[model samples]
Target: MSAGGRGGVRATLSGLTTRGRSFLAAGIAAAVCAYVLGQDDLLRVGLLLAALPLLCAAVLHRTRHRVTAERGLAPARVPATGEARVRLRVDNVSRLPTGLLMLQDRVPYVLGPRPRFVLDRVEPGGHREVSYRVRSDLRGRYRLGPLQVRLSDPFGMCELTRSFSAYDTLTVLPRVEPLPPVRFGGEALGHGDGRQRSLALAGEDDVIPRGYRHGDDLRRVHWRSTAKHGELMVRREEQPRRSRCTVLLDTRAAAYEGAGPGSAFEWAVSGAASVVAHLLERGFSVRLLTDFGVTVSGEGGSGHERAAAAALMMDTLAVIDHSDGADLAGAYDVLRDGHDGLLVAFLGDLDGGQAASVARMRRRGGAVAFVLDPDAWTREPTAVPEPNAPLPQRLRVLREGGWTALGVPRGASLEELWRQADRERPGPAALSGKARG
Candidate 1:
């Protein structure tokens, strides 16, 4: 509602307390019996009973006491399944003291149970603070609330409810598990070499002009840079590149199987988040992108800024949804554009065409693959595997294509897989380059 005052007398009267309603009901019955029995005493009692609640209602409706609420969330951004505290402060601004306050906060069921608080009383011109903890397993942004409080009259015959308009948002980031760090064969180059390679990927606006050569094309001359340098300068046809590590996640609905948190898709997202965090902490410039080409990039930083960037990345990963793309064509182009960088991909099931498309990106840079094991995915979550074959052929396909690939089980720990990856040697083509195979 716009304001408590907006609820007119009719609305206010509708808030008649349970006691009030019962008393009124009893009074009506008594009056009816009195009429049939012709009893004057009963009639007089009935009149008094019926009048009391009405009088209380009228008294409550006339109250001009004003209430205001302020809400706050501590550590508003939390990881999935993490807890956050919500503090709500309510004030009585009117001249009259409040009778009682029954406070309840509105929240979604996913965020756990609603919190209710009881305050004995609040003096006029005074305020009280109450707090509750909320936890959610799901990742997304959730609103905490406009606080609603029930105010009662002294006799308890009537009560009114008022709601504060203020709302607070809590961001639940995807769970980013810490992973052990390991050197990658295609992860980095000599600092100078990497920088030079990065320039080749620069955008037009990032053009760094150089002294014009004898064979330089006139069309390539950078007019602005020439004026600034006071000499003929030609645009360096280098592709601008700063991203050192790219984490590609397959969001195509067809690529993944199952639903919910225990599914391969969710496991992949969580693992991707972990890998992104590990890279950021290691001072690597990172980029996270979906197969559909949606991307989020963060500059390399080790302090407060790193935390902020991680939050940004986590926020994006938290809300990412499955895509409708049938193939990895969008991602293929993205992966094939970088050089002297590390490309880490978390993919679902891959057919021959998809695997071939993914493999072709290896020539542009080193690649690491996390593929879901079809055998594990086809089984129930509670089913135990009997050490049977787990799609060795698919993993072999990616390995032969020069990727350091590992098969991920539906409910397996990513940290364990990271250890396994570090123990294994990369393909010969990994340290150098890969031709389409």
Candidate 2:
């Protein structure tokens, strides 16, 4: 069938009920009998019954009530397991009263239950407001609704439904916990000039012109520099601060194994969020690297800039999903770009090649890894066959390669686990220029 024809049939069927059809059928049969046998009682009853439905249908078919809705979401972005209020204001725009109006705001399954309200009567040009709270224990972006409003006759036989094409979006960010007071001692907490360089880079601004050149915008001329240098000098724009930590999150699906919210993937996400929060709190510029080489960096040391960066990070993390790609080592090249800061990684399951790629970061400053013990988290005894070396062996390799690696067991307290300080290790040798891929 043609799409329009099918739609028309469905629309027609939705507005009618079996009871109405039965009544119409009986009325028609009675009317036929009355006309053939000249029965007055049957004729009167049939005409009255048949006219009732027609009258109801005519009255409802012409129903033209319009409503303007304004939706409000308090704290439009919330952390997982957080509550937010959804308020809706509906204004009637018809000349006559609308029949019982039923309004429901559609919500995604993850965002708790849908909010519903009913108005017995909406007088012409009147308005009503309703509010409800919604909470989600998971993270992601969700659409609140295209409001569904239904109007029905007093007898409930005839009905009309109109969906307002307006929607509101909700973003549920990952939960960030307070980091325990712990630092992997040694160069990981860069001392001396490294700290100074990090601070200086953080305070630097965007590139600006020191002296005006041809094709430069006249508006960019620095009046003070021109007065001092006897030439048209534009403010020099410099690059923003160099990020201090490259937070690489292993999103490769094969690395971690578990199910639902308790899976190793979620634990890795939480660990990443916690580490990012901790780095920001410690006044470090961070570059978030995920899914191989997708990098996100924030430039300024100012409070506003830091807050903006944190918000961006959380927003990005809220929507991160697992990748099917097995080789997550592609992020190493990007990590090699910055050599002055620490490298923090949340690793899932890993193969030898991937582990070796991660070890290359040792040439940089300090590298710390929070490795998930996938075997500990799996429920089935043989969820994954251990035909080769175990996860601890991989972590031992990481530790030997100048990384302060920690194996995280399932059901362990993140606060406690992260807080436990690692033993001091030798600093990485100074390596300049680009490292080979």
Candidate 3:
């Protein structure tokens, strides 16, 4: 017998329905009673009662079932608080007709409950299609799939569950808002030490072939190019200049307050997303950096490279979570290693160490920070003075270290914040002048 037929037999034997079990128990009891009392009538009734289950088991044992499923998503990727429609198509590929079948498409709890349906029957070589909608306010990659179909006997005496091991991934990206162009002071950024240049040079080099230089290896000659140019042309190992922007998002859980979408961490993530989008749109190679110094997305190239990089960055931001393990200062050490055109940070209330790290990043390029007031986001108001105390002290430290720092409320709009940072002065004076009352 075929594997599917053997599987069906095994499933029929193992998956005895409630009614089937009850009938079998009644048959056994009746048979025992009839044997003890020498009653032929009871024995005949027991045999009749037991015949239904035996027939069901035998029918299922010989049945073979096979199905194929395909799943499609209307929009596979979406922003936070977006919805998508999932369409499922199931096809019966067996020669025998399938009995009553139930279908369930599993989904993540964040999206919604699993969608379930019941079908009376699917004829041989027949098909059925179903669709459902899923929505989530949270951001992350979700799997929608592995169609579970339960095949049962006509009388519901036995059931066999078969899983179609197919899955589709839906990526829920972070909410990216538009930001006004903000200028970074022309501090001499590290020239030609960009991530893209290094990666392109070592891994996938995209270069032109020029005339062979002194002591150039014969193997380095581009034969095709040499033939075209009618001269010995060797691959040029020059680093092309591409503007770089590093967006630092603070992810230390202790640094932010509140929970869920309205939390300071989420605000920072949104702000970072906006900054990343704005930079990439302006033709700057952007890299997303976290307090843990994790490089979620590295510098992008022009055109398709930039677009792919931006998409990956937005997807990365969707699932970014706060980390409390890495020291803020230690993480900032990554900033000193490379030169970036612009360093924009979305930060929460910072301690002295964290503030000092921000200061260190100023040397890399034009450092600008959008610092959020954590106390305002908390349930209970803190005693620390907002404008006259802690916020001002932190701003002073960052400004003194040569950073343009803007203090923002938890509920401030990122666009407005970016515009203000663009026109505002650097240092504690800017905070005092633009500090919200």
Candidate 4:
């Protein structure tokens, strides 16, 4: 539902309690007067109170019909946890003036309380615009609703409410951070790297000649070999094989054991985003496999690259199976068939079984890399070991697996590791030789 459909001034004042409160006070006064005065005074007071409600109701009916409303929200698309401003315009459509009009725009529950404002006066055929800010601290789709306008009689004995349907939808996307450059095998993969691989396949071993085709570079023609063979000869170039990189993300919330701003899952997501961004930038086709049961295939071109990144961001907040002992192996099985590239796993803490799963993945022609968030050990370091801790043993198994493992200590940023990854990337000299060959 739109925000306009939620609570507004009209809705609040229209409540039976509000009207009852005013009527009860007037009744009480009449009762007090009746006790002090004679029966005749009580009868007269009863008529006055009764007539007051009718007179107020009449005034409300007259003024409410004259007011018209329009609603709008600026920058309709906002981040999931951000704020936006809404503008409401109320116009007096009739010749009569509208005085003391209360307006309330229906806001979604996710935005907290509905806002209420007052329109003191709207001259005949005149308009007054009111603006308020709303914040959405959570992610989702919200509808801003029917605008409500309220008018109360001058005597305050009665109230009338009018609602206008002004339908609008707002979509809040997930919050994203600037991902640091990620590297593979100490190689920096970004636009600045001239050594980035292309989709075109070129190698010395392939010598099969094919008929000349349109758009084929003239330098690739084998003129000498063509003349002897008496045919239009062109080099048959194979499509360049991209490095298949699969990001294995652990989505189990139980894996997140630590304190501070960075959780295990948060760090994992950041690392995954950075890695995906770097791979796409360097022309490596990347596929994402998350234990959250989300899979987005590798795509080419800048637009597809963006889609892949957004998919990752979307899955970071997606609901996962919270049941105890939910296996990561299920996610691995889903990605087992098609993944031929390096497998990078980010985990909270490892177990013997989980470690064995990583070993199985490595045996399937996938290079393994592990990012261990040490926050699982302890929020603050102490000499005494905590009970039921498996982090120490997990670290030991990871070290022996021949995997590139990095221990991310509590409060330590990933900037250094990112830089190190960049340093390990292949240099221009290597790329140039590969390209020329």
Candidate 5:
């Protein structure tokens, strides 16, 4: 027999039910006894028994049918604790009808359980679709796929399994909080690193359109221009001086207290995500800077561009991990040359030098910093602090350098802190004023 034929036979035999195996074993014993005793009736019985299992195997091998599976993830992207649906479709394309089919799609433990489904039978050219819901409490890009389909005979004598190689991805983003609008202040933020700029109006000349780019929003299409030009055309994008904001996150493993998902590092990450979402919503072009480097950025003042950029930002944050670097110099480097309109950072513990660097990192624009308190996040709870103690001396340095710095203690509300930073003021006061405990 050919290799394929031999493999088919092996697969056929491997699918044998216990009862089929027992019948085959009994048939072999009966045939041996008959030969020894020279009994015709026993020999006939042995031949009949031996043929039964062989017939079943032949039936299973002869009618090989192909099944196909397709998986779909609804909303493909979701935030932590947000739910999404998964739809699965199976089709039987062969000429012959298929027996019972058991379907199971693999999923990550964080998403809950693996969903299993069953089909009574599939006629020739038949199809079936099933769906399940999955949700996760932590952020990450996870795979849910390679549908496993088990084909079984009605008599339970044989079974075969086929798995689809295709897989679908589901991205779970960090917990994003809807922040209240907050106005900030600093020196006149001259457009330094603007991504979008409005075209200077010269009456009718300014209305002249350009060919649509790949990321251009269809809403901006100028049909009149397209008809005149005999090709697709869109309004000229704004000038490259739109307001910009940089959301920095401290990801150094040694900077935060404790470990795992509950560490101060994770808290900083989530807070940074919230700030990014808020800035984009407020029509500011936003970029995510980390201790490691730039994670992602969103450009343009238009809704379409911001939406696409936001998606990319969240996807990047979903899989972000801690950095081994001991310093937050990456953030400084990313902002060194650019004068961002706003600098919002979620930082972990900082010594005097790093704190000074962070303070000078933003050359111009409104700067807000949330410094995580390492004492509160220690693996073991330490002694409680006095009710009216002042914050760390680094924060004073930050205040002197014109950064709106606040200490993030355990159970602190980010929204409240954001509101506090919104008020613009200089040192020696709480909230909008100088450094306070």
Candidate 6:
């Protein structure tokens, strides 16, 4: 049977508490014998005694006569460490008034303890509204329902309980911060290149003509000018060239060893946020990919920019499992084929096999930058006889394989690392000349 059905049975039996049932049986026996023996006074007394328990049950039931419940201010989606409001409405449908009603609503264990709400008195056909502001400090989905309503008699001899199924679900997303500025090695530091190139409009070059290229906006074609020149020409508009950069936030737990109080995943998220913000501020089209199966493609305009920022913040709170590293490979493959931007990966210490995979990405004609945090390998003091070597040696191996690798110390501020990255990135002039080379 359903819980509500069982609760209904319990409510019916609760009226016959041990004492109540005894008192009822005694009254019935006395009243029947008195009536047969023609004892009017005894019969009257027995009937009066029986009325007590019956009246008590009636009063208990009457108070809970009208009940209406509804959820209030339930957010469609909430972030971890955020709060949501749940509202319950109780209405008195009977002509009598109710006093001191107790209610308990079932909530997920992850949501902590179940809360109780009290209603002083509800007049006949009157309504009472109660609300609880619940806070979720963890990430995941929570189910709420099966409200329990209990009403007590004024004399406190018996209680009436009812159960209802009011199931609702809430999804909690991860809480993230604004993406900060980060630097990565590759083509021009602040110039746009690759698929979507940015051009600066100077007075001397209001409408310079360039050879037609694939993916160029057809609207930008200078039809009159093309006719005059007897060839197709595209209009050149001026905007600061934005570098193309991609950030990979590793979600592997194996990297968290010896990391600070927070998990390595948290640190990686923070690093990715910093890098994305830094690149976006410098006019670099930034894309973010996470091993948690989250992706935000590169966007150019201000609105798209805001979306990317929001995605970064949400990603921080995302739940990730490091059970299999295969997901990392899958995410990397998606990024490799779809994005032509400079690649920056923030990972835990790398193994030989993993280092080979990193090298494979670099060979695909993209500037690859790796930030390896040593904390992952140093969880236990005994785990690192030469813990420090793994990071530097891994970088050397990657560099030898033609990938740009940077070793970031555990606990180092993202701002400092970002500056170091900037120093290592090739300047626009340098890249232009490199193309010639």
TM-score of each: 0.78, 0.77, 0.77, 0.62, 0.81, 0.66
Tens digits of per-residue lDDT, candidate 2, 6-78, equal: 1233454367556666666778889999999999999988887676656655555555335567789999999
Candidates ranked by TM-score: 5, 1, 3, 2, 6, 4
Query: Model 5 compared with the native: what TM-score?
Result: 0.81
Alpha-carbon lDDT of model 5: 0.76
Q: What shift in Å separates residue 47 of candidate 1 from its native position after superposition? A: 7.8
Better of 4 and 5 by lDDT: 5
Worst 10 residues of 1 by lDDT: 186-195
Better structure of 1 and 2 per TM-score? 1
Cα distance off (Å), candidate 4, residue 69: 5.1
Give the candidate order by descending lDDT: 1, 5, 3, 2, 6, 4
Q: Write the per-residue lDDT of candidate 5 for residues 218-265, one digit (tens) a residue.
A: 998988888888999987757545577888888887787776557687
Clashing pairs in 1: 200-238, 200-239, 201-239, 201-240, 202-239, 202-240
Against the unseen true structure, what C-alpha lDDT does each candidate score? 0.78, 0.71, 0.74, 0.59, 0.76, 0.63
lDDT of 1 by residue, 257-314 (tens): 7776667888888899999988887767788988987788886664887788788899
lDDT for each residue of candidate 4 in 194-223, tens digit (9 for 90 to 100): 333432345433466677887889887867
Per-residue lDDT, model 3, residue 417, is 74
Error of 1 at 25 (Å): 7.2
TM-score of 4: 0.62
- Stretches of candidate 3 exceeding 4 Å from the true structure: 1-11, 26-48, 61-64, 185-240, 296-300, 380-389, 425-437
lDDT of 3 at 396: 85
